[model samples]
Target chain A: MLNRPATDTQVTHLQRLWLYVLCGLVIFFLIVPTLLVIPMSFSDSRYLDFPPESWSLRWYRAYFNSPEWLQATAVSFQVAFLTMLLATATGTLAAYGLHATRARSSRYMTVLLTLPMIIPVILLAVGIFLTFAPVGLNSTIGGLMLAHTILAIPLVMITVTAGMQNFDINQEMVARSMGASRPWAFLTVTLPQIRNSVMSGALLAFIISLDEVVIALLIAGGDKATLTRRMFLALRDEIDPTIAAISTLLIAFSVLMLTLSQILQSRK
Target chain B: MTAADHQPDAPMNERALDRQARAEQRNLMALSLPAFILVGSLVLLPMGWLFWMSIYGADGFTAENYTRLLHPSYKKTLITTFELAFLVTGLCILLGYPLAYLASQLKPRMASLVLLCVLFPFWTSLLVRTYAWLVLLQRRGLINNWLMEWGLIDTPLKLVHNFTGTTIGMVHIMLPFFVLPLYASMKTVDYDLMKAASNLGASPVRAFWQIYVPLTLSGLGAGVILVFVLSLGFYVTPALLGGGRVMMWAMQIERSMAVYADWGAASALGVVLLVMTLGILWAFARLTGAIGATEGK
Candidate 1:
């Protein structure tokens, strides 16, 4: 693309070097903060001091031994599990329906399903808190799961719909025209074809629920607090290395899930 | 075995196939019902409740909550929200554009590896990322310690708990959102166009600005709208890094609810935010002549 091969070699070389250096700095800025926490979490100091004079696993031990932290972890896992199941089921079904029907309203439905993602979480938190309080659903595990499922469904829908785009519905039709029942054809044929999408969607839903905090802060309380909500409170009230330890673990889990999803997508 | 026997069953088979097709369509529509009901009852109903609470007063329906928005402090919060969003969005564009250009120019494999820098932060938890900034930007933080150790200054810089700190943290979070779209669009620009422009005696920089930059405007616009909207509603990063000095709309709604216990006021602020967001999206769609641009996220 550099057509001025004779006259501009020196200047172009300098420009290329400058571009590389600038991008290298930007990449460093993006990833260093996240990477620094792993070391900080292992620091032996009571306060956050980078390049600790000493290193220890004291914060990891604290995270493990504290009942409240363990309980919050458990609540996060439970909510994430339920959200994965609910969102995957509902979202996959909707994707299939929308793909098959090809109705005019499908566009509107897609927009509606995506609203939870587009709208601010704080607004939804306020809305849910007000609506659920009178119905006695606030602070309950069910309430948190419901809110998370709403958030996760759109992601699942998008993934599954993309998967369906590559799927040929005629295969299912042929299976049905033979001897298989509708449900059987879907289970044995369509479901297997889109299994990767469904799995990735479930993983994404799990991650979303695990990381969600704002709604959990406004609605979840007492024994049902999510790990992130607890982390938020901890940061506000005190600076603890235990929070750092948990952050490291959460980061590791997210990296693992994202890598797994990438592998799943690549295999297809 | 005979033509007559086949002829007798042909119409029956065709009718059965028609019935089956209708059933399948109905079944497909039925399959979507569970998700529809869930969204309607949980998401839509609660949003309606929010709107209702905004207008509902102690005695009857009223616009008092919205009129309260005209007050000076509330107006300041709204203006600050937009200003902060624009500042973060502008920084993302300025920083992200070059990085995206760099990536777009590289070989595909190396480009993705560089893009991973952006994606890693995207995949990480917002709270964790924000907390990392908190650790690095606080009064006794890493940056300050390094600066002081180098004898640059005796006192630690007050980086955290203010507008500067909040902007830094937010830009860190929002950088990838801008880069991914911008890079995707940049990759689609034909490099041969630049080559042709240069062959016509245009300098490389002139070719880039005149040809390449114009081609990337769609992606740039999409990225701007996305980062702006997301930053407008940001709650966590500012709350953690702002040290109570920076106030955005999301935090205001939280304060109205938690501190003031004024649902009407909170809901009213929420409605205003929602309207503003939708208005921006609608205006972008009108300007772009497509809704696809607004779906950048």
Candidate 2:
């Protein structure tokens, strides 16, 4: 009402009140579930009591002290870091290839590359687990990285392909016309221009691996447990404040990564 | 040379240039081969192996696992899965349409703020959001606690560990997937069309029905299909929140392997899911030619 021109105020002012109230409730439903956990993390009770009568950081202390939780957290970071590197290297190459090629097969190649994302994660997890079981690769660090890298490839490819849209391919052609090699032209001219999106894709790749739950559940277990795997099992058994603490940390880390990725994409 | 120079009869050494272009395409495609191989061996190869697993039983080649899908229990699971999918998709549309409309009408900066709020849960770990709901809706949990204190009810409602709990959690996860695309489509509508209708002796409600609603129908259809398709294969939310009563399709596959250790049954279930998910996506792509809208989901 305040923002609109004075002449039209009477039209929307009273009539829109119902719309505003309805939307406010829906928006509250959307945002509150995520923020609800933040207060629960500070609870001093054994169970997750909201609007707690007491408060402390003891769950955070519990998480820091437990070897199992710490080990799971470390494994998640290690796998996510490795997945980031591998997916970025291969996926960036694939995106560049898709951008450069004029062949009709390029469309089919795109469909194949993106199939990982379109297929349900449970199906992929089951397949990977079955394939890995016989070779003793299931629950291993390398297997999880391979599984996660497949999922992350489409994300990296999507961002980098979008990034290449603003770039003039003619600039690279000019570099090549001056006797520079294709690889040399790309390294010197194209990489610097699209580095932000590549970096953003890398960040997204990291986040995807860290928060992955289904694949980790089937293929990751025992000492190879990822943070989400442990959290899922823990939640199935109980709802302790320690899990809340870990959840809070995971939420904070993903928010940071997503914000950084968004900033990177928006900049270029 | 311009693009026309590449035409067969218009250019110098046209066939030679065509050959060179084809060679260049292959060379560039070599860059993608490693990623291609990774996805193929990891996804396609295992999926083929699963297909092989499905067709075999203890004796030799057999259709026992596929035949087992005809049993009453399997039918119940399939029916339950589709029913839940319908229910969740319906609720999402009811809640999502209003929220998306509100966001679309806001100023650019304010709309993004609303979008950021919607995406906050999307960015959070799925498990965290499910856990938050579990805590809030459990019998001894916050919602029940508050309800009792307010004297709104004589007893705490059975919110969790049932069908209701699963629906709530699934709707929360699927809401953003519906809203983002619908909002994008909504932004492209010409508000002038509605105003012009009002000026032409139409009431406000008539203008909304005649002009505004038709413009947004395609977005609504897209959102409905995406939500229903996604809900068919839900695993985590239903498994955790439903607490074994729901028996969704994905959980059925998981149970066949985990509880019964029946590779044949599990493999068969996995194959069916893959077929259904891809089939729907392909059919939708063919019908609407908007496969690009499936991005980010």
Candidate 3:
């Protein structure tokens, strides 16, 4: 974007003022709705409002004290953690495999593995529900973990594959030639170089599982319901400001994970 | 170097080398096995069942499941879904293009701030954002209250639980999807061409329209296809905000399964949605590939 002569910088900036203002509104529209609930969550009243006249942690207390909310939160974290591990390991392997194999079949294999992401969740959820029912895994924690891992893998594959573009396979091959095992060469020579993307992909996998709703809505039930599923059910009943408190916490958590990923990505 | 490129030292060594190379290829391919097994069981196997259910009936294989889609109720929902998808995609284009254009033109640090703002809502829970809109656009919600307080209206407007609410929420959700891809493509474009045109006596507007805009069209097309496909299968925002007034395709699919408990109906609807989504993506890929081939020629 190197443009405009040094003498023309001020003129061009001034000329683009209207464009900036328009974009500013678009950015406001993008972010404000999500951020507004942070304050609304602390309201003394039960309903959501902007710039509360009086502030209290009534809703936060409601979220923390409720056993149901706590249980769902615990379930979400456990499932998400397991999903992150499952998805990252498998997806990273698949990405490396795709990069390693010069075979034409790898192209079709890539599409086959990533198909879950493109298909509608409702269909996947229903299919997963039926799939799990026969195995007696429906409504169980393992079922949720497996379903989410599939959804999360495509993202990991995508990010790790993008990261692999900057790397050379010959380095790993050279290490292998120098009396190192294949896994050893990859772990010692390749993984360190691509660790940033792997870490970012892991974080992404964690968040996708944590935030997924449709599958959880269909397949997760009983005491194992996810936080998102619970919040969704709660919202349908009413706009209890308790959910606003929970949303604020979730928004904060997403920000933290994204920041961590950014740090990992930006670091040398 | 590959084993194939190695010098033929001895016949026994050569056979061992070939075997080692084959083993290495197999081992590399083996790495993808876990993902294949996991996804295949849950996603692919279930999809096969969905196709079967769509055709299967109590008596035998039947076409009634798909034929049911011809009902006026289903037809209405199908029409509404396409309309909403188009409306949201158009709104995203109108809003996303300028923001991406501006972001591409800014300093690197400034551009990141703009991108972060775009990505914030995306990272947040889909349900939370839909809830935010549900609160803001509802009767006696903030927007309606503001308009009344400012004397712009005598009463709170019906801003939500309807088509308007769904559109606003969907657009908010889809905007980042449109902008990020557009911004990436725009960043790769050389703006020096536009400056050269300006120097060569073309008007700024003409240069932008003829040169710069054409360069960004591929990005625009990508954003358009992505938003449209996503919107077609969207369920969360519409369900949370539509108040049962709007019956989009995904909502219909959910209703068939959840309300009617009809696997055949749900599977049939899901099959159509999947086909449309995949069909559009396949067509777009070919269209872009064709354009690239012609340009290369």
Residues B236-282 of candidate 1 have per-residue lDDT tens digits of 98888888889999999999999999888998999888988888987
lDDT accuracy of residue B2 in candidate 3? 75
Cα lDDT over the full model 3: 0.88
Q: Candidate 1 chain B: worst 10 consecutive residues by lDDT?
A: B288-297
The candidate, 2 or 3, that scores higher on TM-score is 3
Position A211, candidate 2: lDDT:
85
If ranked by TM-score, best first, what sequence of candidates would result?
A: 3, 2, 1
What lDDT score is found at residue B173 in candidate 1? 91
DockQ ranking from best to worst?
2, 3, 1
Decoy 2 TM-score against native: 0.93
Candidate 3, residue B175: how far the Cα is off, in Å: 1.0
> Which should have the higher DockQ, number 1 or number 2?
2
Q: Which segments of candidate 2 are over 4 A away from where they belong?
A: A2-11, B1-12, B290-297
**Which digits, one per residue and each the tens of the lDDT, describe model 2 over residues A183-238?**
99999999999999899889889988998999999899889999989988888887
